[model samples]
Target: MAGELAGHAGDAANHGIDLIPIVALLAAAAIAVPIFKRLGLGSVLGYLAAGLLLGPSGIALIADPSSVLAASELGVVLFLFIIGLEMEPSKLWALRKQIFGLGVIQVGLCGALLTGVGILLGFAPVVAFVFGMGFVLTSTAIVMQILGERGELNSPSGQKMVSVLLLEDLAIVPLLGVVALLAPHEEISLTTRLISVGVAVGAIVLLIFLGRRIMNPFFGILSRAKVREVMTAGALLVVLGAGLLFQLSGLSMAMGAFMAGVLLSTSTFRHQLEADVEPFRGLLLGLFFLAVGMSLDLGIVGENWQIIALSVVAYMLVKAVAIYVIARVLKSDHAEALERAVLMGQGGEFAFVLYTTAVTAGIIDGPTNAIFTATVIVSMVLTPFAIIAMQKLMPKRVQPLDGVELADGLNGSVLMIGFGRFGQIASQSLLGKGHKVSIIDNDVEMIQAAQPFGFKIYYGDGTRLDVLHAAGAGNADLVLVCVNKKGDATKIAQLLRHEFPLVKVMVRSYDRGHAIELREIGVDFELRETFESALQFGAHAIRVMGADEIEIEEMIEGVRVRDRARFEAQVLGGVTAGTGLLLSNAEDQARESGIAPTVKLVAAEEKEERAN
Candidate 1:
């Protein structure tokens, strides 16, 4: 009876102890993330600092960093899955040249250079090769997160980096095989490596088959259930299951999750799955960074600071130079090549995996592994700062506008600013009616691209009064402001309204609020950018829902009339003056009864209120 009582007490104590780490982590993140973000250091560095503080090498709040790191790897797995969601098969095919061509060359070159550096530092060729190859696999999470923060993940340069990361993830399996072969143990045979490779290939094939055949149907059934939690659970199951299959096959779990995501990229549930996985991905990824921070041993660093410091500088310098040269040789411009080099200069999380495997295979002893790991961590810590410094120091390069005409003293009946999609479509009506239109845009690439398509777009900033005058805005009968940015469009509208009041202006409003603002500025005409398309979309939707075509026409007209009335009301009184003019299903039912009177009464009240 006494022993049973003791066991219960011990269990209670253990449960309580578990909550402490949870509280500490949450508290640390709440404090650290905001401060770091405010200071412009970013959230990753914040997590690392928090982890270092909570680690055994510091206050010892978390005893085992290895277990935390192991569990936190799920963050990386989910991160890859989300990345895969964005890469449709078509998009993947489009990036194949960059992935296979640019990626292969960068990794090959960097690996060779880094290995040479290791050998120069007195390491054996095999050991140096392992170290060099490990560093070649840059940190996908850090680079991706930074790219996302800067809104560059889909940019051409960012896409190239992403492609290289994918190739690196794929390289891990073969690298592991290489490590096995180089091990002192005679049992590590070529046959074992071949079996592992075969198993990995079979697993990938199985994942692809299941994803294409089963995922959509499975999601369809869960969606029908209409239980939100169940849909979220289903998403998690798919991610975790794919990861497990790859892990069992001795491949990267992240690669498996990525494969699953790509398979589902074309499915109807793609957006739903991405939304469900996002929250978990964020939390886990943060924890992963924290775990990495905790794993950094001050004892090891203090013992071998000089060697670790020298190695980090040498490795990063060699890797960065190689990447920059390779990128330049492949036709990337100077600025882009420099940015890529800085962003990918650091060794990644995979270095830990490689070094751990090396230790197990008797390739390197514990102390050497510790020193190498420490160097990688330091490099990771230094990367963000390096990028910030580069951004500050690097001079912005102006793109050469070769084969493109500048906005000179040309005159046309209609002056169109910005030759983007909207401006292009808007110009057609004027052109069809035989009005000469002069189009000006600041985008050199867009202007050059439009040239082959017979668009004589000249390089000019519409927001600049001098450029507008040069583009014949002063003499044109009709001035069309069609720039995409709200600020630029507004600035041009204001400029034309003040400088060339004789010319009638038609401006593209970004939204309803922008429409009101534009109207207030007294432009001759203004149209919300998406207003017509959205109305047409709604009309089509109603038609598809079995509404009579005549009734749909009436509804569309009613909406347009109501929108116009609301805009006038809003322009007269404020944005709040047009509430009663909004058309809803409920208003549709009451339209014949008292809706018109109510709208009139609301408009009158708004006028009176504004006057008062």
Candidate 2:
């Protein structure tokens, strides 16, 4: 009895200890992320600093760092999944040259150079090769986050970086096989390696095929069930299931997760799946960085600080030089190439994964892993600063195409500001009716794609007054602000309303609030983009619930007309009404207009008619 009690107490104590690390990690991130963000250092650094403080090297609060690392690795897996979600198969195909050509050259050349250097520095051939392959990868998460935050992900250098990162990610699959083959006790032959590769590839193809077949139906069922929690669970199941299959095949779990994401990218559930997995990805990734900080062996660093420092500096310098030279050789301008090189110079998160795997497989000892891991951490820590400094030194210049004005003998009285999905549909309808439509867009890729479709789209910022004039906006009979951004739409509308009152302005409003804002600004027409679609959907649901089709249609039409009038009245009244006031007004208007009869009044009238 006493022994049982003691065992229970021990279990309780162990659980308590586990909770301490969780609390500490959360608190550290909560404090550090906002503080760093406020200081303009970005959240990646904040997470790293949090990990550093709570790590074993600092206060030594958490004794078992390995467990944290094991848990946090899921972050990297989810990160890859999100990346896969973003990369539609069509987009990937379009970027094939960059992915295959530039990406291949970057990895192959960098790995070869690093391998040569490592061998000269007294490492075994296998070890050097492993290091070369691993160190050549850049941090996709960090670089991508920074570029996306700054809205540069579609910029020239950003596109190049993305291509390289995608290839590097794909390369991780085969690289893992190589790392396994190089392990000391693993005597896997060439035949075995080939077989393993075949199995991995087969597994991936099978997963993607099956996923494409079932994901749509599965999500359809879940969506119809109307349980958001269940839908989220289904998404998690897909990601984790793919990861499991990859792990079983002796491949990277992240690889499988990514494949799953790519497969589901075209599904109707893509947006919801992204939303569901994003929080998990962000939190876990932060924890992964923290685990990295905690895992750093300070003792190894203290003993070999000088050599570690020199190796880090040398590693960054060599990689930067190699990237810059290769980019320039590939026909990129000098400034852009320099920017790309500087941005991607650091050792990646994969270094930790590779080194850890090597240590586990007995290919490299603990001391070697420590030195390399420390170097990777330091390099990653310095990446944001490096990017900032490089940006300051080489500010990104928006180079306008030389002498590329609107094509001769092409004129349209209708001006479409954005040529995205919304604008494209509008332009097509207008064109089909024998009405000429002039389109302007800022996206280079979009402009290029539209040209092949026989659309003469001008590439320029629509918000700029000069660009507007160049596009013949001055003589436009109607200005259609179909841009995705609310601010951009508002700006174009405001510009047209003040500059050319004769020209009718039609703006796409994102939501009710946006429509109100646009109306307040005196735009002639404001179409709430998804409002009609939502109403149609609602009408269908009402019909499904056994309402008469004609009744549903009439009701929907009444509501739509009344709502539009109410919205216009509220806009003109300059009153920011709450939901309660809005509902009250809607009720009063419905009763006064006789659009909807009161239940009590209807019942009383029926009773009186029966009596008569």
Candidate 3:
């Protein structure tokens, strides 16, 4: 009876729903992410540290990483789904030359180069294949992390990284299919494998078509029931259920997650669902990184440091050379070629999965497997260093001079830094009001995108004094730094203020605190995107509450003194609307009080005229 009871308990534990892992991940991230953020590192690295501390290898608070792994697969799916949504057909088509042509060349050349190196080191063809494919992928997390930190995520280099990543993402599936073939599964012919793939793909298409017709409506009704637990439960069910279907259907759970993301990517409620799923995704991905850390196998490292060291060296040198050669072939400058080469010449998250699968397939013996794992992990561990190295190595390329380009256009105009969403809006608003505006950006793609839409955008970084002059900043009446990054925005504001002392500066800040910093930097105007959205949302709510337009306007004015250029003490301080509201309210009150004075003066004048 006791044995039976133990069996039942074990079964329940294995299959029963538990949310502790999710909760713990959140708590850990909440504590660690902000601390790391304050330290000028990144939230992701902090989360990685948190995972290492909480995972089985550390305190073991998150003992079973299986659940986290399962959830992480979904995160990747959603992430890819969003990528697909962002990449419309036209954009993808335009990128065919890069995505397919250049992408194939890079992947093929790198794989062949890496494979030759791997085999020469005595790896079986299967192990070499996995190693080569895995090494070909750069760390998306690391590259994006660095880009985000420097506010360079939208730069020309950044966009190139995106295109490269997208191509790698597409390549990952076929690489897995190749690995499956190397495995010692029951004797399946080549035709059988191809047929299986065709069938699986067909089924996926059918399921997706069915899902688009049925999934949203089903979710809508479920949501309307207003049960918080049900919604969370349903989300988990979707992830697991879809993952199970994928596995049973002879594909990876990760692949299933990816397909699920693709379907949801086109959904009308993508943002809302994404927001809801984010916490789960983040925790799982964090734990996944932690798992990678735990899998480091310090014992193996100690015993085989020599082999690991050589592998790591060969890995970086070969990959870097490959990328460097490719960049040069593409006609990239010396600086750009080196930067891309350094940033990408390392293994990534997918390496772990590929290596493990290859080993399970008898393609690698025990010792070879250990070395392979170590090499990948070392590559990951070296990424932050690589980024730092790249930063140090990245030169100014060309020195900043008095005038880089001739002031071809009219020199006197409003310098509009950034040509993306916010900047474009600003330029139009100013232009519609008859103010001359000159737009600038560092992204060639964004410049091209904006130009076709009739935007007056030029390619250049706002921080560069040369770009500023080229944008007619010297003679501009005012300068608007509408770039989205706090650092970049602040940097531009400082540059303009220092170089063109007479150019009035206005900056677009991300938040209230950011706006304060901009104001401290003497920015003539600071507009926070969220503040405007919040104001609009609040105004809509007031209208819904039956507030008249005049009353609503007055109330909005009151709110404004809480945010805008107002010296009203009440708005700026304790238990009241901020400075913006008070200034607007005071103005409204003064107008109200002036009514009686005007009426009495008018009546006295009429009386005097009648008396005369």
Candidate 4:
């Protein structure tokens, strides 16, 4: 009877759902995320580290990783939804050349090369093809998160990376179909396959058309209702509904979610929807990455460490070289091309999906699938380190200034130091008003590039007084410090204020602290680089939410005036700018400006109540 009871308990433990692993996973994340972020390794790596600690290979605390992974797949779906929401249809259309052109060539060539490698390793042709296709994909979640964190998503290199990843996502459907054909599964007729494809296309079109028609009104009502929970639920429903529609029609759920996002991108509710779903997307995606770490098979890795290492090195080398060649062919500069190659050299999350599909379809046996999965995981685990290494190895290249000479009497009323994006904008605006502008920058490449645009930029470090004198800073009416670095800006501002005291200095600051430092150095005209842009964005958002234009403009102006006053007051008083001080000053300013103090008080009270 005791033995029978123990056996029954064992059965119960096996069959019954347990919450311990879930608790453990959350606890691991709670501890790991902050620590990793503090160490500057990022939260994705933190999740991976947490998973590694609690996984079967570590303490064996999580008995069933597949269950955790299954639940975490929702993160990927939501991630794709957010990505879609951020992208407009027109933008996607604009990227069509890169998406189809560079993306297609990268996959085709990478797939072929990896397949050849697999064949030489003694795998059958079908298995080699599966391996090649699976390995051609780089980790979209990891790459995007890293790049987005660095604020490079819209940069040239970032765009190229995104274009390639987009194509890979689209290519999954066809790749799966190919795997199905290669396997000994029950054969469907060619006509039926074609019909399936057509149906999938029709479903996508129907989704976009119907979504565009209904989503705007639906979100409008939700926004007017002003129930945050209801709005959040509505957002989730839209994403899941679209994802399910696509899944039922034999397309990727993520693909469907992306389509839904594009349809809603132009809606006024876009920002609200993004705000509602961002927290969920972030948490779930972290969980997804944690699940990936848990899925790594340490036993297999231990047994085949040498082969796994060789495979990973070979895979990255091959993909990196291929991607570099492709980027150059697509007109990318050497630095941008190398960055793309390094950023995209790892196997992606979809490898797990594809490998499972192949195994289930009997195209690849269990052992081969295990090896391939292990290889992919190892490559992904090393990707962040690879990115860091590549960045360190490939410093930004500055063009040579050989044979370049500044024009004689290069004196202008406006002396613009730094010919980067910020400097260019300020210079162009002044020039548009018919001001004579002389530009100076340390980046020789930038000066060379700007020459074709009729900009006569002198290559020199503006912080050096010799370079400034050579550029005729003494006779200039105003000196605009538009350098990229805060320290450099401050340095040039000090030099001008001390040496050329008569020349007015207008400096661009990176942030609040930098602005304060500039003010301390007696630069009267200082502009925070992104401050006005952010305020303008906020104004537009308020307008979209039904604020009157006149009222919005007045409110913006009042806030700006008050902020400037408060900043000056804090600097003069030698008080550090903290949240409490900021709020107190804002309330005082609002009262003085005859704004509604009750509204501000109520908002603050509500926020405190929510925190409680």
The best candidate by lDDT is 1
Which candidate comes out best when scored by TM-score? 1
Better of 3 and 4 by lDDT: 4
TM-score of each: 0.70, 0.67, 0.61, 0.66
Candidate 1, residue 212: CA error in Å?
Answer: 0.5
RMSD of each: 13.6, 13.6, 14.3, 14.4
Candidate 1: deviation at residue 377, Å? 0.7
Task: Write the residue-wise lDDT of candidate 4 on 64-164 in tens digits.
Answer: 67788777777777877877875778888989998998899999999999888888777788888898789898888888777656545655577778888
> What is the per-residue lDDT of model 3 for residues 1-612, given as tens digits with 9 covering 90 to 100?
334534554565688754555565668778987997787556666766776666554656555555565445455554444344334345456667776766787788988998888887777666777787888877665665455445454456666776786677667767777787777754668898788788678757765874578766766666678776676666556555666676666665554654565566545444445545656765555565655554555567779998788778888889889988997898887777788888788787767667767777767677877777778877876766676667666764452232232223545467777766787766767788887676667666676566556765555787655567666778898888888777688668866765688888888888765565565556787888677778779898999999999988876775675445432332123223242233224444657887433222322444598899
Q: In model 3, which regions exceed 4 Å deviation?
A: 1-39, 50-73, 144-156, 183-186, 215-247, 252-266, 397-612
By lDDT rank, best first, the candidates go 1, 4, 2, 3
Which residue pairs clash in candidate 4?
A: none
TM-score for candidate 2, please give it.
Answer: 0.67
Return model 4's CA RMSD, one decimal.
14.4
lDDT of 2 by residue, 1-612 (tens): 334534654686777753555777899999998998898788878888888777667777665677988888788788788778867798778889999999999999999988887787678888887776778888876777666554456556777898898888778767876787778866887888788878888888889777878887898788778898998999889998999998888777877898899888776566579778989988998897788677766777789898677767877888999999999998999887887888788888777778888888888887788777887878888887887687678754545464234322335789888989888887877888887788778876777777777777777666655467667777889888999987668667766775578888899999887787677667889898888788899899999999998989876876676576667665644334322222235545778897784433332444598899
